[model samples]
Target: MTVIHNLGFPRIGKQRELKRAVEAYWAGELPQGALLQTGKELRSRHWALQKAAGLDLIPVGDFAWYDQILEWTCLLGAVPARFEHAATADVDLDTLFRMARGRAPQGKPAAACEMTKWFDTNYHYIVPEIQPNQSFRLARTALLEQIAEAVEAGYNVKPVIPGPLTWLWLAKGEAYTQGATDAAKLDLLPALLPVYQDVLARIQALGIEWVQIDEPILAVDLPAVWRDAFKGVYSSLQQGSLKVLLATYFDGLRDNVSVLNGLPVEGVHIDAVRAPEQIAAVRAQLSAEQVLSVGIINGRNIWRTDLDKVAQLLKPLKAELGDKLWIAPSCSLLHVPVDVEGEEGLDAELFSWLSFATQKLDELQWLRALVDNKVDATVEAALEAQRKALKTRAESPRTHNPTVAEKVGKLTTLQRDRAPFSERIAAQQARLNLPAFPTTTIGSFPQTQDIRKLRRDWRSGALSDTAYEKEIRAEIERVIRFQEDIDLDVLVHGEAERNDMVEYFGELLGGFAFTQNGWVQSYGSRCVKPPIIFGDVLRVMPMTVAWSQYAQSLTTRPVKGMLTGPVTMLQWSFVRDDQSRADTCRQLALALRDEVHDLEAAGVKIIQIDEPAIREGLPLRKADWDAYLQWAVDCFRISTSNIENDTQIHTHMCYSEFNDIIEAIAAMDADVITIETSRSNMELLEAFENFHYPNDIGPGVYDIHSPNIPDQAWMVELMRKAAKRLPAERLWVNPDCGLKTRGWPETTEALKTMVAAAKELRQA
Candidate 1:
C-alpha cells in the first residue's frame, strides 16, 4: 500500500484558462467574481484529474492568482510598506494584484514587488520584501479554504506551503538590501514560526493529516547559519497536530543530508530523479517512523519516465518502508506544461517520448502499481508502450544528424575569440554615431493584438503569404516611424512576425518540434510554449534577417538584428535528454552562429543576442558553478564572436544578481549589455560599480511588465542614480526586457519618457 502524491500541479489550465481569465480581469473586460469563478473551476477540474490519476492525497494551496510565493507573502502579512496596509490585516485579491502589478485605483501606482527566477527554472516568482522587525501572522485563509474545497469534493488533501526557512531565505530583507549579511535575516525566525503554527493548526482543525512544506533552499549552498536554522525551524514547526513533510528539490542535498537525521517531522521528500545517489544516505538518516517520499519522476522536463527503471528503484524501498514509502515527481509539475494529450500535429514517434503534467501523473500511477505488485492488464500495456517508445527514441534516425555533429566537433577557440571590447566599442561608436546616454530598447517593441491575429491567420492558411508579409512590413514601418519620432538612438523591428523569441527561432531551425498546447507559465498571466529540441540543432536558414533588413530599410538609424542566444535557446526549451546539456548547447551555439553570420551579411549594424537565461541556467551549488559558467559563456561567445568589432554584440539579462558572475559575464565580451533594473530602482548597477565593468550598460529606466506609465522625471532620476556610479557616456537608456506584453499606449509613452530622460542626462 505504497502511497503516491504530487508535490504541486500546474496552475494554468490545459488550454491556458487561467491566463485568459487573469488577462481579461486585468483589462477590466471580466468582473472580479468571474475571475474567481474561473480559478475555482480550474481547481476543481485539476483536482478531479489528480484523483483520476490515482493520487492518494491530492495537493492543495499550489494554485495561485499570480505566483505561489506572492500567495505566501499575503498569507504571512508580509506586504511591503508602499501598499499602505495593515501588517496583520488579511490581504484581499485587489491588494494582492496591486502588489504584483503596482496598480492603484487612482493616482500613481505603487512600485511592484521585485521578480526573479525561481531557483534555476524559467518560472518567475515575486520577491517578498521584509522589514528589519518583520512579524508574521496567518493573514490569509486561501490555503485552508482550498483544503476545505478539496475535502468537500471527497478527496484527501495534502496542504502545501513554502517552508518558513525557505520563505525567509528567498525574502529580501531591508537589512540585506542595505548590505547586511544573509545570516542576520535568519534571526527573524522567532517571530515567523507562530504564523506557521497557526496555519498548520487551522489545517489540523480541517482534519488534514499531512502538509507539504517546500524548503528547496536545502539543495543550495547555504551559509552555515542558514543551514543551522533549518533544524530549529522544523523542530518548532512540528509542535502541532498536522504532520510536516519537508520537501527539497532542484538539486541534491549532499552534506545537508546529515541535517535531516532524527528531524521532528512525519516525512521527508527527496528529489531522487536529480540526486538518486543520495537516496541511500537520505533513507539512512530518516527514522523508522518518518515517511520517505522519493520524487522518482521528472517534473521540470517533459520526457516520459521509464516505468521499468522507476519500478526497480522503488521496489527495494517499497519493501523497506511498506506503506510509508511515497512517490512523486522530482519537483512541482508547475515547471512543465499541463497535458500532452491535446498536442496536435507533433510527430507520432516524438509524441510517444513526451510527457506533460497529466502524463507525468499517469507515469506515477503506473510506477506505483508496478512497485506494489498490483499491475493490471492496462498498467502492463502502458509499461510495454513506454518501453517501446523509449527504445524507439534512443534509436530514432531523426535524433542524429552527422553533419551537425561533425561541425560541432571541429569547432575551435577561434570562433569564441572576439576583438577586445575597448576596441569594439570605439569602432561601434564611430560607425553608429550615437549620442551620450544613448536611448534604445532591449530588442522588441509592443506586439499588438492585430499582429497576433495575423500570425494565427497566416499559420492557419486563412491569410496568404503575400498578405501576411505585407501586413508585417506595415507593422515594421510603423515601429520604425515611432522609434524615430521618439528620437531613440537605436531601433528594433518590433518582432511583428515572431510569436515567441525562442519558439520563433526554433520554428526556423532544424531538429526542433513544437506543440499546439505545450504552454508553461513564465510568470503571471504570461505563458511560453517552449520548443522541444528532439535532435541535433542546425541553422536551416536565416531566422531574423529579413525582418531586420526591412526595419533597417525604413530607418537611417542602426536597426539591431535580434536573435535569441544559444544559451537562452537551450535553457528556455524542453531540450533533448539523450545528449549532454553542454553538447546540446554547443550545437545550438553553432546554429545561432550561422544566423549571426547571416544577420551581419545582411548589413545589420547592431545585433542583440539576448542571453537572458544565462543567469537562470547558473548551477545552484558554488562548487558546480565553474563547469556550467564555462560552457554557458563559451556558447554565447561562439554565437556572436564571429562578427566584426563594429557590429556591437549586445546581450540582455533579467532579474539576476551578477556580483559573483561578473567575470564570467564580462568574458562573453558583448560590446553592450542591458539588464532589468527598473523594479529594484536601479540598485542592480552596484555590481557594475564594484567591478568597474568595461562595456556600456543599459540599466532599464522603467518596468515594461507593468501597464503603469513612468514619467520623464522618474526615468531621469533612475538614470541619474546609474550615472553616479558609472561614466554617463557608458550608460544607455532602456526598459526592462521586451515590450511584447504591453499595449500600444503605454509602450509609446514609456519610450517617449525614456528618450527624454536620456536627453536630460546629456544636459546634466
Candidate 2:
C-alpha cells in the first residue's frame, strides 16, 4: 500500500491559541507552565488531527514555542555565550525566548539573536551565533519528548529535524575559523553530525521507524564543498537503525538532484508541486528500494487542489513503483492557515475555490484513496465538487477586468517622473519646507489591545459603524497631536484603521478573500493572515484617502499617506497561481496607482508606499534575479509615478540585505526611501554610499522590532555613523519599521528620544 504523509502542520490552533498564550506569557498574565502546556496541547491536537485524517506517517518534532530553527540551535547545545549559563532545562524557556526576542526581565538587558527571512518566505528564523571554538552536544529534550509523546499516543510518527548541511548553511558567524565564508561554516558540521547521530540513535531506541531529515538547501545553488559534505553527514546518519527520508522543498532540486540521489538514504521526497517537470527525471534516478515521496499539493498557497491533475500525475508512478510510492504536500503546511471551514462571511463562491491546511490534508488523503483504488461514493462526490469549483473559478466573470487589463497593456514611459533626482528633490523641498535631518515614522503606530478590541467588536457587530468611526477618528487625532508635541518634522496618521498593511488594502480591493483563522507565523508570536488574490486585482475606490485627509486636517506638518507598495501587496498575499507573478504584480500596481492619485488629489504631500517585501521576493539564485527585479522595480514605479514631483513619494523596506539590490532599489526612484538599519548598526548604509545614491535616505535610528528603547545618546551615535556615508541634508530619521507591535509607552518614549536625537544632529 502507498503511504500517505504530511511534511508538517501549523502549530497555531484554529483560533490562534499559541499566539495568545505566548503573548500572555510575555505580558506576565500567563505562567511559564501555562505557556508550555499550551504548546503541548497544540502539538497533541495537531498530531491527532493528522492521524484522524488517515495519514500513514504523521510528523513530530516540528512544533516550537518560538521557532523550529531556534529549537534546533538549543538542541545542538549551540546556545550563544550570552545565554549559555541559562541553558539548563529549568531555565530553557527563558533562554530560548531571549535568543528569539531579546529580554529585559527585572531590568537586566539581553540582546536578541539576529533574525532574517527563512529562504524567500515571510517566515523568519533566528540566526545562530557561533564563536571560534564552538562545540555541540545533544543537550535539549523538546524534540525527543514530542516524539515520545506522539508514540505514546499510539500513532506512527516521523521525527523531523533540519538536516546537518542545511542547519550549518542557515547558521551565521565565523565559528570554526576567523573571517570564514558561509561555506566555511560547514566545518562545524563535523561537530554537529555527532549530535544528530545521537538524536537518531535515541529515536531508534524508542522504536521509531522513520525520521524525516529536511535538507531544503538542496533547492538552492550549493557550493561543491557543501554538496560533498551532504554525503559524509548522511553516511554517518544512515548508519543508525531509524530509516531516513531526506526531504527537499520550496524549489526544484535541479543540478542538486544528482547529489541527493547519490546519498544512501532509505527514501527521498521531492517537491513535485514546485517543479513537476523534474518528476520523471527524479524517478529515473531512484532505486527500487528507495521510497519516492512525491509532493502533490501546494503547501505554501491557499488554492484548492485540482484532484484530476494530481491523480493523473500520481497514477503512472503507482503503476511503476506500487508500495514504493508515497503521497505528500510540497512542503510543511506551516506556511498556510489551519482550516478554511472555520471561515464565516467569506464569499461562498470564493470559499469553494479555497483550501487551508485542514482542507489540503483531506485532498492528500483523497488522492491516496484514488491511487489505491479505495474510493467510495462520498469520496467520488467530493472529487466531483472540487472539479466543478475549479471550472467555475476559471470561467467566472468576477475574476476578469477589461479596464484593468487595458490600462496595464497601454503603459508608457510616463510611469516614471519627468524630472531628474536633483530636480525632484528641490521641488519636494520647496513644497514641503522641512528641516535638515527630518524625523518621521515608517507608517503605523501601536495597534494596542484597546484598538484591537474596538476593531474586533466592530467586526462582530458589537459596536456600531458610527461608534467605530468615532473611536478611529479619536485615535488619529491623538496620534497627530502626539507627533506635533514631539516636534517631528513630518508625521503619519498611525494607520489605526488598518489591521495589516497588505490585508487592509486587499479588503478594499476587488479579487480578494480573507480568512477568519488563516494565520501564519511571521516570527516569534507574530502571526499574519495573508489575503488570497483569486483574480485580476482592481481598486474599486479610494482605500486610504479618508484617513490621510483626516490626519492632514489636524497638522500643518506634512502627514504621509501610508500605502503598501505593489510588490509588497503581491509578495505578502496568497497571489493567483494561474497568471505570471509579474502580471499579477502589474495589475496590483495599477490598482495602487489609482489610490495614489486619490491621495494626491486629497492634498497629501508625502506618501510612503512601503515595499518591505521587495528584497524578500528576489529569487534565491542570483542568475534569476535580473528578470525578477526588472518587473518588481517596474511595478513599484508604476504605483508611485502618477503623482506630481512635489507629492514626495517615500518607500520603506525593512529586515533585508539591501547591498546586493541597491542598484535595482535606486531604479525605483522614490523621492525618499527609509530602510531598517539599526539592527545591523547602520552597516546597510554602505551600499548607498558606494553607489552615491542621490535621493534622500532614512537609515533607521532605532530597532523598533526590539522592546528595549534606545536612549537619545544612542540614537545620536547611530545618526553620526549614518552621516559618515550620507550627506546630513539628505538624511531622514525613522524607526526600523511600523510601530504596530509595540506598546504605547515604549512607542512614545522611543519617538521622543528619536526626535531629540535628530535635533542634536541638526545642531552638530
Q: How accurate is candidate 1 locally (lDDT)?
A: 0.88
Compare the candidates by lDDT and give the number of the best one.
1
In the order shown, the candidates' Cα RMSDs to the true structure are 1.4, 2.1
Q: For candidate 1, lDDT tens digit of each residue in 1-764?
A: 67899999999998899999988887788888999999999999999999999999899999999999999999998888888877657888878888888883433468888998998999999989987788788888887888999998899999899988788778885466522336777778888999888888888888899899999988987767777777788888774578889999998899888779777889999999889998999999998999999999999999988889889988998999998899999999999999998677887888899999999999989998899999999998999999999999999999899999899878873557877777888888899999998888887777777888999999999999999999999999998998998899999888988899999999998899999999999999999999999999988888788888888988899998898988899999999888799999999989988888888998998999999999899988889999999999988888876688888888999888888899999898888899999998888898999999998999998998877788899999988899899998888888988998888888888888788878878988
Q: Predict model 2's lDDT versus the native.
A: 0.86
Q: Where does model 2 exceed 4 Å of error?
A: 84-91, 104-107, 174-182, 412-414
State in Å the error of residue 381, model 2: 1.9
- Largest TM-score belongs to which candidate? 1
Q: List pairs with backbone clashes in candidate 2.
A: none
lDDT, residue 190, model 2: 70
How good is model 2 by TM-score? 0.96
What lDDT score belongs to each candidate, Candidate 1 first?
0.88, 0.86
